[model samples]
Target: MTVGEVMSKDPVSIREDDYMTHARQVIRDNFLRVLPVVDEGNRVLGVLSDQDVLNIRSSKSNVTVRGYIRETPLITPDMDLLRAARELLDAKQHHAPVVSSSLDRSIVGILSDVDLLRHIQPTKRSPASVEEIMTAKVETAYPDDSISRIWDNMLHWDYTGIPVVSHKKEPMGIVTRIDIIKAGYARIGTANMHGRSSGGSMRVEKVMSTPLYSVAPESSISEAIGEILRNDIGRISVTDGGRLVGIADRHDLLRACLEGTGL
Candidate 1:
């Protein structure tokens, strides 16, 4: 199959002249890691990813979207879908725009790792357990930890969310960037910048999403993939007897698809 077959058509785009803050808000609200940057005529300029926004915040820059544009490998609709997934993986990005042409810059659609997951066809080479693709180096936060600690971890590590655990390291909930941003908006929190408490009212437990979606370490990739799609979540924890062991997200699924392994 080709990229156009599974690509998200008519993707949301932003102008080059738009503000970085606006791009951040757009990403936060849309739950996207990357946004296609286009000209007034819908010509592709480049892409602004979550990394770009994070880098801007870290540097305390005033750069606009235009300044933040990073060169992206051109993706045309006719390319083999697997190749497209590989390109995205090599770029260390979760998605990319499908354009009419590299020189022309008209984006026809977008392809994400999640889109690639839908294309995965199980093969004999596929592994039977989720362990192969799961990320074992998890950065967890405690429920009692201050919200500022969670914010620092996310900022420095680019964690989409951190599993909330107890002193015994048993999973309790999950704290995400969205939750922190919402708290910041409500409390007018300056803790993210100042590295202080959000007036001591906010805690990791307060913002964490409880009753998390999870899977067992020995679960099949097919089963994990099904859960991910069904729940529409970016990631799911891999537990062994109810303790967090690893995480499998869109990237893991993409790896399985491309390798035709770890089903």
Candidate 2:
């Protein structure tokens, strides 16, 4: 399939002159990996990933998106699916702004890893287990752990989600960057009044998402993909006999796809 066949058209985008506060809110609310930055003429300038917004500090001033705009592999609607996916992977970008052409920067659509994963069936090429692609060295959080601590860990390690485990090391819930961006964005005096403060007093259990989504380490890569797509989540916990083992995310799945299909 071609990129145009699966790419999301008229994707959510932000103007170059828009404030970072607004950009951060848009990413938080849309659950987007990257937001296209465009000019007044609707020409693509670049993109702002979730990581970029996570760096936004809750200070007295707000910055415009222009300064934070990042360059990404420019994708065109007519490009091959795998080729486009390769460009994204090569550039270390999860998504990119689809343009009319290399010369014409007019934004056309947006293509993400999720969009391509739906078309490429890795099972058809190679029957690899989730364990082969999962990140074994996983990071986790305890329910009793302070939200402040978890937030610091996520920023330090650049983790989008951290599994919340019980004292017995069993998965209980999950805490994600979005969770912190919502529950802990405010660290000033007003955060105390809002009750969602990221201060040491707030516990991870309070902000962590319950009913953890997980799959067995030995599960097929196809099964892992299904779970991720079903939940519309970035990553899923990998367990072994009810114990937290690893993590399988879109990046891992797509990397496996490229290797398996030799795309």
Best by TM-score: 2
**Model 1: per-residue lDDT, tens digit, 191-219?**
34345455563577877888778999889
Candidate 2's TM-score reads 0.88
Local distance difference test, each candidate: 0.78, 0.81
What lDDT score goes with residue 10 in model 2?
A: 86
lDDT of 1 at 79: 88
CA lDDT of 215 in candidate 1? Answer: 94
Model 2 residue 7 distance off true place after TM-score fit, in angstroms: 1.2
Tens digits of per-residue lDDT for model 2, 1-263? 89989988888999998998888778877867689999999999999877767566663446888899889897998899888988988888778889999899999999988898888777466547889888898888999887767766776777778999999898898998777667654243335313544445678887889878999878988888899899878898898888888898888888778775566
How much is 19 displaced in model 1, in angstroms? 2.5
lDDT assessment of candidate 2: 0.81
Worst 10 residues of 1 by lDDT: 185-194
lDDT for position 177 in model 2: 74
